[model samples]
Target: MVHTHAGFAVAGRPTRTRRSAVALAVALLAVAALLVLSGCSSKPDVVPSADAASVDVAATVTVKDMTFTPATVTVKPGQAVTWIFDDGVVEHDVVAADGSFVSELMTQGSYTHVFTEAGTVNYSCSPHPRMVGVVVVE
Candidate 1:
């Protein structure tokens, strides 16, 4: 009588053996490598900064009908406030009541003033006393 080894086989093909296990291991390693590579290429959402530039604060007021557009303004200390003269016919000046701040006569031009103290400063146009504005520094 003749006998054969008992393993996986088909009627017309050879049986699978240790070679199939090696193929599966290689495929799994390839997939894991792809995942690791993709994760390394991603970037963070926000960037870090150590030294940022200072900000410039400015404002404008018109002299058409002798009135300030925004009668009052609030800002941080050390911030600059600019008053622009939009009307061509009239001249204006920005002068603080307590002599805290002042600007030269602006004839269709812009005037800038920097607030260094934390307080409310009442200012008005020298030529037109009716035009009043306030700067609140915090």
Candidate 2:
């Protein structure tokens, strides 16, 4: 059957502008869906440094497998605490929540911080914030 607009004979379909609008709407919806999905997806995996596996454990906190081993440590005031990145396949860093100390991007070896103030100090790897640890100085 033929379609009509304003009593005029036309094809049995919508106008070009109407079709284009539908197509544009579909395309926009698809783009929006992709954007939402991309935000929900997992983040990129962390890669270990070249010398990560061979480091000694001189640190009180150890970062491995995207986790902080021995997540909490207790010590007396003025005692020194250290953090070592022992994960062979992930890079990490340490930062105190209270601006007390910060470590360089550590993939191996240790970073030492002496706690002089008596309080609880919480820290996490900057690259992997989920990897959290704490130190209690009494």
Predicted structure with the largest TM-score when compared to the true one: 2
Off by over 4 Å in 1: 1-55
lDDT of 1 by residue, 47-112 (tens): 121111243565445555678778888888877676767767777777778776566665776666
- TM-score of candidate 1 to 2 decimals: 0.56
lDDT of each: 0.67, 0.72
Tell me the lDDT of model 2 at 24: 100
Q: Could you tell me how far off, in angstroms, the CA of residue 42 lies in candidate 2 after the best superposition?
A: 21
Ten residues in sequence with the least summed lDDT for candidate 2? 43-52
What value does the lDDT take at residue 58 in candidate 2?
30
lDDT of 2 by residue, 1-138 (tens): 767796444965776667788899999999999997876643333332223234332337778888887899887775677676788857787778886777777678777776777899898777677888998888
Count clashing pairs, candidate 2. 1
- RMSD in order of candidates: 23.1, 8.3
